[model samples]
Target: MFGIGTYPRGGRLFVAALAVACCGFGNTGTADADTFIPLPGGIITRELADGTTITIRIDEESAKVSPSLGSTPVHRNVWVSGVGSVDLAGPSADTATIKISPGYVVGCQMDISSLGVNENAGESNTLSQTAPYITPSLSESFGGGITLAPGQAVARLMLDLEKPDDYGMESHKRYNKVPGPHASVTWVDEAFEVNGCGGYAQARSFVLAEIDTTTFIGNLALWGQPFTMG
Candidate 1:
């Protein structure tokens, strides 16, 4: 349940967070104001257990908030990509094991590409399929966007969980404040696995992202929520 609308006000959020941490531009940046927010990308398809066809696609999630020296505002870093594919609708070809249930990637090295998949690449979100979720479902990859259909595409994964951490809002005593791109890539459990036929199958899907810190600092914003299970 995520399909709101409003991410283009005039000039794509008005970048000002010290040029998004340009390289060293942050001695407490923030001259006056110009919040920048833009988030929208989603898609999730499911049908695994032998007749594989599990597709998940997230184009680009976003976030930016600059101006930090003490007041509170500096969570710049954004660039996310997704594309999970599997289609063995019976008859022949098989062998599938897509895994990326991993939390968040803030730098690099979360890549996977398969032209003729025989995969085992970058595996580590640790969730091993356990099927059993026809009701207690929940979706919120920020809260909107998912459309991927056409034989269910194939493998592709990219990450840029930008890093800036240190957004002082102090909700209470946790301090995480949704920093570090947070983390939420679900498949209920197992995320992926399909080898020969059947006997044990369970691989649903779900994603949730956040980064819209706008209370008054530089205006930065980006809410490309994501969530889906089928």
Candidate 2:
């Protein structure tokens, strides 16, 4: 469920609030129960070099965690949904373009909180915080299940753009671009599976944006609250 669209100013991206649910599953449970976790999405505002103000928001985030159909201690399954949006205001607002890339960081017995950018950091500092955890260059296809060991982590992008290159060969991109003063990307029920982690595991969502004002270029990112995958 990937879509790019224009959202009107001051409009809400998601109409309804998610109800929190309580359910648990593990290696021994019925394997049919699902736990729903509602996440507190985040927002960031940055003033670019040329006095262009860019705001990035991650909203309507939630995840459904379930025992792996494999019914093994090392397998886990999850369905995630969220919306990523960007709004530009200031000198170059009318002619700006935005590229939105939404993804997740999954860790096996590792603390992923530190891998995210500092929300309080300045524009230059935030742009410099491109650790592999935040900007993963992995070649693996995200929808395909991933395998991880303890103390290891991986980043999986939710958007995969397939297009033809200049040579007519197939190419893929992790981000979606749209002309904008305001643009958004929505994803629903995107599923990913994890395997080979016998210990505790966790996942967090993030939205990264590259903004081109036709004069100034900048980057913005927002991170969601991390949740356990049982």
Candidate 3:
């Protein structure tokens, strides 16, 4: 993975900027500080096994990091937003279904910079590779907040769509599904909290997309730059 406006076939790119806010209540250092990171989202173009071309783009993504309202060393807060888009070309493009899953990977005292679209970040075991492609697990959830210890990491999805199931029971989904040659999912100012980490913490954004067409099914992922939580 790379950073910011870089497109290297199957690689990733991200760019970030940080702004520090003035402290209040006589607090010093990074305590009570707020940081705004502007991220340059990425784009990926891939050709499926049946000669279908798919493009996925992560755009208008950013995060605002600040001290948690608890004001404790073990608590952190962030607000994130992004847009995930998909476009398809070639055969079966008109009848394809796209599923978009946008989420964040939070690590406690561990460097998650090496986590790529093809590798599972120590959280799930369902990631499998099919020659030049990977199938990502889509069973992540956002259960209020995250708690992590040193050397531990978690993947929290940003969306939870509540709808009626086949039997009229409530069903929750972590991804948005759409049809055809183009689709998009947009999230704005979604806030999440992390706690129980006594060391430095970091988080990165990702968009996992699955394209199901008449001829073949494929998966694509785009990643953002990692930013500090404290």
lDDT of each: 0.21, 0.66, 0.62
lDDT (10s digit) by residue, model 1, range 41-151: 344433323332323344433323222234232212222333222111231112222222212211111111111111221211122221111111211121112212222
Q: Which stretches of candidate 1 lie over 4 Å from their true place?
A: 1-34, 42-49, 57-62, 70-103, 108-119, 122-125, 128-230
Task: Write the residue-wise lDDT of candidate 3 on 107-198 in tens digits.
Answer: 88987666555442222221121112222422233675888888888787766777898999998776666665776777788888888998
Q: Score candidate 2 by TM-score against the native.
A: 0.78
Model 3 lDDT-worst window of ten: 15-24
lDDT of predicted model 2: 0.66
Give the lDDT of residue 203 in candidate 2. Answer: 81
Q: Top model by TM-score, which number?
A: 2
Over 1-230, each residue of candidate 2 has an lDDT whose tens digit, in order, gives 87788753322111111111111221222223488877767777766545656777878888888877657888888888989887876666666566677888888887666565433433332211132225342323356587988988887778777889899999877777777678888889889888999888888887777665433445566777778885
Which runs in model 2 stand beyond 4 Å of their true positions? Answer: 7-32, 117-141
What lDDT does candidate 3 reach at residue 70?
A: 63
Query: Residue 150 of model 3: what lDDT?
Result: 88
Structure candidate 3, residue pairs in collision:
3-14, 4-13, 4-14
Candidate 3: misplaced stretches above 4 Å?
1-32, 49-51, 118-141
What shift in Å separates residue 61 of candidate 1 from its native position after superposition?
Answer: 4.5
Q: Of 1 and 3, which scores higher on TM-score?
A: 3
Residue 166 error, candidate 2, Å: 1.9
Weakest ten-residue segment in model 1 by summed lDDT: 14-23
